[model samples]
Target: MSQLRSMYPPIEPYSAGTLDVGEGYRVYYERVGTPGAKPAVFLHGGPGGGLSPEHRRLFDPNRYDVMLFDQRGCGQSTPYAGLEANTTWHLVSDIERLRALAGVDKWLVFGGSWGSTLALAYAETHPDRVSELVLRGVYTVTKAELQWYYQFGVSEIFPEKWEKFQAPIPLSERGDMIAAYRSRLTGDDRATQLEAAKAWAIWEGETITLLPNPAFSTSFGDDQFALAFARLENHYFVHDCWLEDGQLLRNAHRLRGIPGAIVHGRYDMPCPARYAYALHRAWPDAAFHLVEGAGHAWSEPGILDQLVRATDRFATAP
Candidate 1:
């Protein structure tokens, strides 16, 4: 059996700054690893999930110069959690702008979950600019995909967690959980908003892991984190992420010539394994690894092993 790899050692950014991406949005980005090694960009998940120090450890410091950024409203970006001008395409444009700023004609694109969705959009829109693609916990945010997670499928798996997720809204609004949460998440009632936010955020935190992880779960309950996570997630889901149904899968051909890897945990709650399988079928050029005994989080052992291996394999590739 091939040995499973792990994340590279923790490292600090050699260069970091915020970029003015227009509409009053300043995206926070940083570069890590050797100054002019192979270029790669890391896209954090959640649509709302901001960049973290741990994310920088995904690529080897000696082999890659990776760009990690907080998209739009989250993290250090301006107007924290603001929704305007935050769509799938806006993010794609921001990425292109970042590329131009970095002066790299093409770079590797790595993302997980919603980040995977955004990566697909960006790659499809500008195929020539992507030298390679590495995706984990692939989530396209289709209606069926969204419903499987927020509405029905995962609910059946984690009834207890589902109950907690459903607690913020009354039984009457249970039929449309996304909309119900949206009313509160984007509402004027501060207390109720926070209540709904924690519930919404915690539900994802609780269910995403294969086993119980209190510290991981609790991080979702943080006030500011929960507010941005809950609101932005709901906003994107409510709009189906502005994606045509099955768009990412339908557009998979765009990534064919680019070297790629698709890694997914068998038990990933937020993203189903089937979609990753579907993507693999559509983009046969990419290697696919269905990790055993893992969940959606990037920290999952089996999933991380595959991701790290993919980065290492492409460290010197064109």
Candidate 2:
């Protein structure tokens, strides 16, 4: 097996399942590894995006009971990006519900990028329920972070792509890329939505992975992918991730004593290492692992190895 495969070996075959979390909504989830092992839950990024098979490898199946779930309106959930009870608070409640359904008193939380933001928020609200945290490519959803992602960050690094993303919308609309995309994506004009989605995906792809191009196609040819991408991003941004200003940091007091490890790529463009540094300063007790040459892609061998190791260590600990 390749090193990547070895680090994240497939576990005992498991089946996918869904739960009715009330309000006529169902949350989709999958299980891997043994039932009696230490529980570890994976939160996917994109708010609207659901968990993928690759996410299961972050923990050692022999030692950890791994769970990957798509939040409401995401993945296999009943309504894709359905805004009803889909705020950040609702997500936290869903995690609690999932824990009870999975029959675990506490579980390790593993997340990256936007997932990391959710993990932090959830941990803050339910510190006692979290055994530990394994986070990477930390995203806080701060005003500065959003501004950087939309206006200054990727544009400074990849000006050509930035220009293409900005060209479709007028200067007045530039202040809020999320709003502009929402207008286009929800309009009656299919062509407009396609153009806007392409621009949005292109800008996101350029910064998220190490590759020069996005892993996803820009064409709205895939209805599911395009709809999920557009809807989830808009939901999170419109609500500022359902977080007040500096809420994550403000809530750090709850997580100050938690056992946690943060892994961030030094060169990550999506969520800069500076955010990781700020997190470290707040929770000085947490371990910070800096991946020198990697970007934000968790698929990178170095990041995968580090993540697996962190999970193993946390799972095996007393």
Candidate 3:
């Protein structure tokens, strides 16, 4: 564990369980903090990613009852990336069902990146069910954002990593990296899928973590991290995240009265700070905290501290 992890109070692992969402799908999650305390649910990023133990440290275990669940087709969830019935809408519905199963009428929604996007979507659909929101690394599935990620933004700065990311596909397919990676990742050729997964992981790892040029860890190999990642990326990118362009902000009216906070890194290369600023401008009532000298990494000292503080405030505030 990092020294930073030790600074926070120990988070005791609570119940590990699964919620059946029908169609042979099961969502797995773990609870931390006091069970009877105010409910605060965490939405992990990555349409195919799962929650990590360190993610639970964002909240003060003594003051809040924290719930972290892997979204459908990710983490401990069954039929990983099966996509038989998985969709953004299905995710929002799964949340509603989870709340009912957990017996919480309302809870704070905490998410970052893709998680933040889902949080906004859910709050828009069911504002009454959300008591508040604390979002980090906001990602609004806009075409501009997608284009930037796939072609212009990160690649502009990290050309070396970009080169590796594009090595698997020919120059002709480079223009449509998402499609190329999806076709290879979903194809019967395991070696090709693994190679694509490596590239994808390398690109993501280089950007999301603070460590410089971090090497890909094989520990997640058995976890099927690559397949799950490619599947979900294809699922979202293919459909533009199932949004009709600017749908999130256009529906911002639903969250007009909700108490919310946005924490973003000014130097973040993954999602960029511009998106956060735009969201803050749209929802002036929501507090926005931009951390200087921080990138997209959650492990950055300043960024992590701010994130935990935000959650602490939301968990304790009346």
Candidate 4:
């Protein structure tokens, strides 16, 4: 078998800055690789996970001009962890703003997990502007999807972690996990919020991989990252990402001609394989990959191999 592709070597952003995207928001963006080389954009996951230097290495540094950014309140974006004017549509608009800022008529759109949801939203809204699409972990933001991760499905799989996740809210409030978390995540008690954040964040970290990844799991426990990740994620899920149930799947026709790649792990807990299968059925034009022995993280070997192949394939698309 051929070697599984991995990230290109780490490279710092050649140019980085903050853009005032209105509504008291300054979205942070960075450019890596040749400035104006084959244009592409990277959308980070978590709704608030922000960008990492590793995201820069997803593309071939010598070939693609890539943009990675912190959406709304993420990374270097303003009012750290603030959730005003932040919604699926707000983020879709942010993508358009960034695309305009890139000065390219169209560029490759790559997103994973929550990023996949945003990529679909953006591409459906502005189908004419996307040159190519690459999605990973394929979250559709449906009520069923939300329940799978936060309420019952994953809970059974990780009972101990679920116990920690459940400890934040009392028994009565447990019926609606998203609502329960949303209450404290937005509540004024700093102590309660941070406690809930760490628990909420760690749940995702602990369960996202097929096997244990201590470093990956540990980072989710960071006070700062946890707060934003848990808040943004709970906020988005509670609102169903402001999407009509099954809206993205219903609109997959918009992606039919977009030339895409959908990669989902077979054992992904947060996002089930069925949804990715549904998307594959809807958008038959894009290639579908169901990786064996992997979970949801893009960092997983099989998942990363597929992601790198997708980026490299599109790096020189016409």
Candidate 5:
């Protein structure tokens, strides 16, 4: 029941640059807050969801060296919506590359939704590189988890929104929404891609919040943003995040000694609370808080409050 601390004042980054991570990919990153402070990297959600200025405010400007970056094909990255060479592994490597370029030995990691998935993957791969973790709206991206949200589970609750999400596809393709959307999202035609992108983005926007977010604008406003978000999300989901069945969960053993925190909404439609619970169970040593009266959106007051507090706690930890 802790409340969210007021976010640090809006501050510009002390440094910003692009790191060429090969494979025709360049990541856009910015270092904000104290120049010589505890380094903390912010992992954005959406395999394609890029970084925003608001992301930098979660930390204490005087205490944390906050780093925010756009994953491949995202935000200010060189190729807008370019899916080539983008995968879960590529992102993990990009993080290490960014870390090396930043000259940090180890730093805190913060992420939610798909960010949480990538955070877990990265931490497991290089446990020595992570000082601590703070994850919100956790998602392991299992096949069944994908089906539950897209196939049928969430639709039961938000049938109307699901209908809009389903309308773009034909009855024949209804059996597999991800495949149907993927065809158009990554298709050759620009117009077709944008339309499908909006449909895909709107469905997620409408469903992510427990209560409708009047302030929530469809992320598809920027054609590039929309296209990349849908295309990348579908791309990752179709390939099952390029992970083996239950890979993240099975590999949870690697997170044994890492200090961590999990903050989840009781009614997250995109990634249900059960997934978070399961992750907490696996990483039994980590702290878990279930925020009631909230949904998947990190903007939700309760969810944001807990998330901010988690980061604050880790900020002060030895």
Candidate 6:
């Protein structure tokens, strides 16, 4: 496995604020590094995964002014686990709102997993506002992608994990795991909801890497974190991420002039390498690297190494 590049030293945001995006939603955003440095926005995974301190370390604080935020109902954002008025479109717009609020005209868009999906959605919507893209564990939330993860694909590899993931739902509902989980995650009983949330969160947590990562497993216990993570994930999956089928790839033309790098794990079970391959086929200008000995986790050594190198290359780009 290739070793990951050394991450930038951990640092807190120099400025932070919550922008009310209307309909009772407020997104928590922060800016780190030299304020006047080249601007970059980090889009987090899970649609509900939100941001972490470690996420901010992906970019050099001196070379790039980094923006990180808890989108809609995740992380520090209000209405924890909220699903109302939350859609892929809402998040794309939220990104724009934060950009204007930060006074940045254009920026490098860095994202992984669902973040990659949102990055594509946002770039396709306003390609003029994106300077570049650095994506990892590429996922475009296509119907096939969702079916592969939640319905059929991943089960073939992680039967054990799939069994546990499906334990919460009946066999009949197994065909529609997202709907089944959505029922429990949005159910009235707190106990039932929390139990389903933990299952939903842990199943993905345990499977996200090539090997077991105990540290990642621990986050499944945070009630608020799991609740939002599971609820929002299930909600998005159930809705097919609120895009026309094959939207990201269909709209690849919009990214014709944009420079991009796609880094994906060869062994990514949740989001197989095929989606990244399909995207590369569509956007041939975007560089694509298939990292060996890795899975979907950004923490994977090979995947991380490639991602950091891609970012560094962008830092020096004209």
Ranking by lDDT: 4, 1, 6, 5, 3, 2
lDDT of 6: 0.89
Per-residue C-alpha lDDT of model 6 across residues 10-68, encoded as one tens digit per residue: 99899998999988998999999889888899999997998989898888888888889
Q: Which stretches of candidate 6 lie over 4 Å from their true place?
A: 1-4
Candidate 2 TM-score, true structure as reference: 0.92
**Candidate 5, residue 90: how far the Cα is off, in Å:** 0.4
Q: Number of backbone collisions per candidate, in order?
A: 0, 0, 0, 0, 0, 0
Over the full model, what C-alpha lDDT does candidate 4 score relative to the true structure?
0.92
Per-residue alpha-carbon lDDT of candidate 1 for residues 1-318, written as tens digits (9 for 90 to 100)? 888788788899999999999999999999999988999999999889999999999998999998999998899888899999888899999999999988899999999988999999999999999999999999988888888988899999999989899888899999999999999999999999999999998998898889999987889999999999888899888898998998888988888788899999999988989999999999998999999999999998899898999999999896
- Tell me the tens digit of each residue's lDDT in model 3 across 189-294: 8888788776776577667744574343453334378678767866787788888898998888779889988988887887878888988988876898897877
Candidate 2 residue-wise lDDT, 1-318, digit = tens: 445433566554475788988887899888898887898889988766677776787777778787889888867888875766778888889899989988988999998888899999999999989999999889899988888878677679878878988988999998888788778877778788777766676566566666554354433225566566666777688779889978898778889778988988888887888888889889876889888778887877677778877887798875
What TM-score goes with each of the models? 0.99, 0.92, 0.93, 0.99, 0.97, 0.97
Better of 1 and 6 by lDDT: 1
Error of 1 at 17 (Å): 0.7
Report how far residue 104 has shifted in candidate 4, in Å: 0.1
Worst 10 residues of 3 by lDDT: 214-223
Q: Write the per-residue lDDT of candidate 4 for residues 39-131, one digit (tens) a residue.
A: 998999998899888999889999999989999887889978989899989989988899899999998999999999999999999999999
On a 0 to 100 scale, what is the lDDT of residue 134 in model 1? 97
Cα shift from native, residue 219, model 4 (Å): 0.7
Pairing residues by index, what is the TM-score of model 3? 0.93
Candidate 2 Cα deviation (angstroms), residue 158: 0.9
C-alpha lDDT of residue 283 in model 3: 88
Query: Candidate 6: deviation at residue 94, Å?
Result: 0.9
Model 2: residues >4 Å from true position, as ranges? Answer: 1-6, 213-223
lDDT (tens digit, per residue) of candidate 5 on 211-240: 987545445445777788888899999999
Q: Lowest-scoring 10 consecutive residues by lDDT in candidate 1?
A: 1-10
